[model samples]
Target: MTAALRATGVALEAASLIALRQVALRSRAEPVLAALPGGFATRRKGHGHEVADVREYVSGDDIRHLDKGTTARTGALHVRQFHEERDRVTLLVADFRSSMLWGISRAFRSVAAAEALALIGWQGVSEGGRVGLLALTPDGQVAVSPRGRVRGVLDVIGGLVRAHEQALQSVMAGTVADRSLDMAMSGLERLAPLGSEVIIASGFDDMGQGMEQRLAELARRRVPRLIRITDAAAGKLPKGRYPIRLSDGRRLRVSLSGHAQTQHETETICGRAALLIDAGSGVEQTARLLAANLPADRAP
Candidate 1:
């Protein structure tokens, strides 16, 4: 069995998350929080106190906002326009599939994913936004609705820990598979609110067909950030033939001496990711990379 499958202990705890928050607060001007679109202001109009403009009433305009004095003086129907400052929703999608259970670094890919999730979650909540979770595991999937303030952040961290434990159990039993990622993506579409910012933390080893289309559809309405987590071993394989065993008790032999495996893994995982975080990298490095890559306009 892989070391990751047999690993014990919680990869992340509430204390770790709290520490991260303290660090983030100290470096508030570093743009780390701005990496996530969750902190950015949205353009969706709503009934707010701040008047944006005053214009002639249109057929579809809300009648309740009609300006009676303007209509009477100009003999034309007018409506008051207002702009609302809405909080952005940040959804953390953690992939706990069998593939994520393998790592040759300081921790498992799943563990790295959980750490990244925590950092992003804290950043979103600190920026006055809501945080939610979508954990996809071999045993099953778990969804936590977005909550505001500290409660929401804690809920997401709790969900990550639970999903990791369940995934570990599945790995130990050798019942892990790779069919839940597609389903999780589907769930993301249904559960995500309009204009929400989504962070997908995974290795993308089992990215199924039609994933690009689904992501395209999601990007149309929401900001989708791909935090691709991979181990160093995945990029380079020693020249030799290796025996591989399937989760279903099947055994097969494959040659890793050639570049085929490396190329395939790169195309499958790295090619599609917007941001790549190595499993061996530190959590602070991941946060800095994400912040640096964010658009200048999005920076807080």
Candidate 2:
């Protein structure tokens, strides 16, 4: 590789690492007390022990939750209401396909996706919740079960870094795979428990058949988040001929002067997601968007 390409690679890696560290630090100051409340709201009522209120007993109210003292004093039946404590499992799914290997801006889409995953994992862990990862690489899928504390977050980050390195190597060797995002989503369905909060980060280039059905099923029981990693040049190639080098030491000239945009304008996953991340926006911008969208007690 040329010195310029190597330098760009290094810069991309460094930026991602910095973004991870910043997210970790910020999470310590303000924990995600609620399970992604705003966009990721589960809409399921809390079942915690903390009393929220009390009201007259309804026909369908749980008889066991009836307030005995209140019923006796008022000569009427009443039920105790408790505050809802959200489930604490956070799962991050990332795509590492060959398509992510290309970038027209500062760095590859894969790098940005990795950075976003790291940030979200760290943030979830800092809030005293268990975090896990499901990585879709050129070779196959890698799954990491959720774990509590900082160590779990570290493990997920390590996996992301390794996947990014592997993706770069695959691109160089012209050995990239054409895996679909649906495979990763299927893995998520099996691993993630009901009521878990899930965030999927990817370019979403290859969404296989029946993907909509899978997403809908997951959304019914879990809070879903989507991060769309894309290049600035996607669907907007300049009007000129350009020389492109292939991984097999071959150069090809391509013209885009009259090429109409062929990429899809929207993603099916967006319909089921509460939040979306545009990788072309850079780390800081993405982080800010997450902080704003995520449900937390204070600004992260």
Candidate 3:
């Protein structure tokens, strides 16, 4: 049992590292960290790599320092231009209420879901993108989105883990998973035309496909992605008909002998459901399947 637990930890850590590496590469901040911004590459007047012809300086021009050659040619002092792009925002939603607290593995569904959110948020912050938590449950509060400093990334992950522990200690699942199911989708709907990237991280064990259908509508407007985190237990029941004993000592036999069929059904549901959110696919064995479906540009 101890060995099995250790193996699980190793797998989880490996999964997080894989996601972190991917985010680092996609951000492309390695070599440039040492050099000041706009210093490594020579600035071109136009989009080219070298000096193109220059024209009269405009109000929007940088005009910090103009190219002498361009000034000598047309006699207009214009600042050099460089390549640039606007940063994109990635909204992440985490559900931590009743439904996610139950699972079939060493970790419950909530733990895996929180793990996915942590990695994805780390990626968004590392890439200098805006990250926000749209909704949360049990606690009935949102972080209001603090700036994604490196320390802030670590803090958010730590806080999420701590929050889970507190929930367990305090027994805060008094509310049902369906407490705000429709309302949650309503919040998602308001974020239409996400323009940037939208990521919804949840066990997705809520009530029905109403929120999912709304998510499908939202997907049409922007770069949409879904990171689904599920463990083997949540995917299917364990094999054999063992007595399911209750806390009150009541026992019932469950007929899960057809393990293969059950597993197939669970996988099918997860896959087809993901299609509704424009997600390519997902992972059922562990929380690491996020590497494949993350934003390509944000990959290592």
The TM-score leader among the candidates is: 1
Which segments of model 2 are wrong by more than 4 Å?
Answer: 1-19, 24-38, 41-86, 233-237, 243-270, 273-276, 297-300
lDDT of 1 by residue, 1-300 (tens): 366444433254556655666554444457544333333445433465667888999899999999899899999999998765447688999998877876675778888888877777776666556889999988788789998778898888888878877887887776766584666566787778988888898987767776787777887888787877877665576778888876556889987764533321122332343566777777677666654554323522
Q: In candidate 2, which residue pairs clash?
A: 46-84
* Alpha-carbon local distance difference test for all models: 0.71, 0.67, 0.48
Model 2 deviation from the true structure expressed as Cα RMSD, one decimal place: 8.6
Which candidate number maximizes lDDT?
1
Q: Which stretches of candidate 1 lie over 4 Å from their true place?
A: 1-14, 26-28, 31-86, 236-238, 257-273, 294-300
Whole-model lDDT, model 2? 0.67
- Model 3 agreement with the true structure over 1-300: per-residue lDDT tens digits: 135423442123434433553544444433221111111111123343344354567787666557777788776676666433225556566666555555554555555566566666666565455555554555453443544546555545555644555444333333332454445545554442246566666656553556656555665665555545455453355566756643223579776754543322122232333311111123221223343344324421
For residues 70-189, could you state the per-residue lDDT of candidate 2 as single tens digits?
999999999999865544788988787766766776677777777777777766655556788888877777688888677887778777766666666666666765656776456677
lDDT for model 1, on a 0 to 1 scale? 0.71
The TM-score values for the models, in the order shown, are 0.71, 0.67, 0.55
Tell me how far candidate 3 lies from the true structure as C-alpha RMSD in angstroms: 10.3
- For TM-score, candidate 1 versus 3, the one ahead is 1
Q: Output the worst ten-in-a-row residue range by lDDT, candidate 1.
A: 261-270
Q: On a 0 to 100 scale, what is the lDDT of residue 293 in model 3?
A: 42
